[model samples]
Target: MTITVGEIKYTNAFPFFYYVDRNKLLEKDCHFLIQTPATLNREMKAGRIQVGPISSFAYAENVDEFVLMPNLSVSANGPVGSIFLYTKRPLEELEGSRIALTTTSATSVHLLKILLKQYVEVNVTYDEMDPSFDEMMQDHDGCLLIGDEAIVTSWREEVETYRYDLGELWKEYTGTSMTFAVFAVRKDAIARQRAILEELYTAFVLSKEKNRKEQYASMIRHIQKGMGGTTAFWNHYFSNLVYDFHTQQQKGLLLFYEKAYEEGFLPKPIESIKIWGDVRTHHSSLM
Candidate 1:
């Protein structure tokens, strides 16, 4: 049976799929469904796709239905240039003010809430809406943007806005890395197509390595054909966006879930993160 995969169609997730497309590994055996993170989150929950990189917050809520892909994630150590909070005033001064958040983000919304509540100690009202800075700022004091939009907006120096990087904020608050997204597969999908899933996992690891070796420059140039931002900006942006769920990232993810649980962002308690297979021993090529 063919494996259907849901992929986040953004620059942050490009590294994971770049090598797969370059090598044509899934040309016949795989089907890809690409969309924004929010759409993929909803579709995955509806059982429309077998696997995808989902928001860390989404994984915590669906722990029983999903298991994570080992050693793969969209994370950042300190300043992730992709997730930002653009505001007219400082974060501390935004108490009781209105903040428009990107509806496309699952983790960022909760991250912002945690920062505002626990760190900033402010009581600001938040509304989730489309990620348009102009429209969002028209009615709100601040707005959160994730992925490509946030990257693009941060470069707009003439917008007269203060850009707060959520990843930086989380690190400052918790002193650990932040994992925005995690690769996850539905539990039943794993049970039914274990071999195919293993192959895909290998492909993912290989793609991540290809990205680290600077082989993705050509692919990034191709995607930049019509996109904003210069090649240098894109290069630096992707460089800061990391892709491994190692010890530090794993700790960050669990800490995020714990904070979310304490802050009531997650409805249930998450004792530990789950993995699909033994990542360390399952790196052999399945091609």
Candidate 2:
């Protein structure tokens, strides 16, 4: 079975996909489609690809069709450096302000909305545009940015702006971590591709273990060569993230879905999250 994998083309996602056992996939080729989170979300939803890390909000949109892979997610406890809101005014004063939401991610966009409406209690106008910091700032009071673009641009230090890290803010308001992306497989594809998917899932688990232990240094170095951040900075950045999706992460995700629904952004309330595996996690792996 030729399996198609959607890879989120972001520095924060590299650890989980970098060390896959491609040569061991039952002699079938593994095709990779590396793109932004929004694109992967669409591709997975359309069944064009078997599995990938999709925006958390996108998964909630079509939860019935996707079964989450065990213990795999792009999540963070606090201060995820890659998702930021650069504003000229304070959070309290941003009511009725035009905010530029990045088109590259659905989860971040919705997360921002949840934060603003539910937590901050401010209603702001949102405009979706490409993640261009300069152009976005021209017409909006603030702009939301995520993934590599936000990572590379240190808007907090370079400019005199009010910077908010969504992850940190979520923790402050909700008192829990936030999950941005999840690894999911189409529910229909489960019966046919079970073996291959199990192997792939194990490989991903091993990769996350190895990376979290000592392998991420190399990833950070490579990202530095291309993305241009100090090794220390990159280390600090990735340290804030958690790859394994366990009970806490699931609760956080459900809370997000709840907020999205309450804010009228999510279509319906999701009572529970569905995982492919029976257990919550394969918790320990070379940690």
Candidate 3:
């Protein structure tokens, strides 16, 4: 069975996926489609794609339909310099002001809301808009930016603004990492094509391990061209990102879901995150 997989085109994901694409790690039966996080989320929900690295909010929204690909995610412990909130004034000072949330993001937007409500305790209004710094700052007191655009803006020396990394902010508030995205497969796809899905998962894990070398930095910088910032900046950006869904990352993700739920961002709280295949079987046995 040929399975369609979605990949997001972002520097944060370049390390894990760059080698996968360059080496053609996916088997002939696997197909890849590239798009933004929001597009991939919509495609996966609509059954147009079987598996994808979707926003954490997307998974929270449809938990029963998706099983996370074990040991693979995009997370950050602190200061994930990419997902930023460029503001006219300090976060606490933005009370009752309008914030322009990026329409391209689902998770970051929710994280921002959680931060403001749970941590900052500031009353504000939000509206979705295109992620242009100038346009966002023109009318809104702050703007949420994610992926490559956020990274570029974060490193801009000319743009002196209050930059708050949502991941860093989440860490400060919860003292845990923030999981932005995770590779997940539809429940129907896993039930129907278990073997193929296992193969794909194994391939993905192997691809990540194979490219753990420092030399991959040059390749990553090449892929992230025109996103601004120096190679070191890109390297550090990717370095802060974690791909494994270990205990710490899992705790962080669940806390995010909990906070989002308390803030009225999530419709309901998720009990256990479903994992694809027998990846968690041994761990489950120990427990």
Better of 1 and 3 by TM-score: 1
TM-score of every model? 0.93, 0.93, 0.90
Whole-model lDDT, model 2: 0.85
Which prediction has more favorable lDDT, 2 or 3?
2
Per-residue lDDT over 1-287 for candidate 3, one digit per residue giving the tens place of the 0 to 100 score: 67798888886776556545422434356678888899899999999899879998899998988889988998999988779988889988988989999888889999998899879999899988887888988888889999988876766679978888888889888899989999989988977777656656666666576556664565666765655466676667667878889989999999889888887777888767887656422111100
Instruction: Sort all candidates by TM-score, best to worst.
Output: 2, 1, 3
What's model 2's lDDT at 35? 95
Q: What lDDT score is found at residue 96 in candidate 2?
A: 91
Taking all chains together, the TM-score of candidate 3 against the true structure is 0.90
Model 3: per-residue Cα lDDT at residue 24: 44
lDDT of 1 at 5: 87
Cα lDDT tens digits, model 1, 1-287, are 77778889788898887767523546547788888888888888988888989888889989999999988999999989889998889988998999999989899999999889999999999898998999999989999999888877777777998889999999999999999999999998876777767777888888788778975687688778857667788778777877988899989889888889999878987888898765333653433
lDDT of 2 by residue, 72-176 (tens): 999998888899999999999999999999999999999999899889999999999999898999999999999988976673376778889999999999999
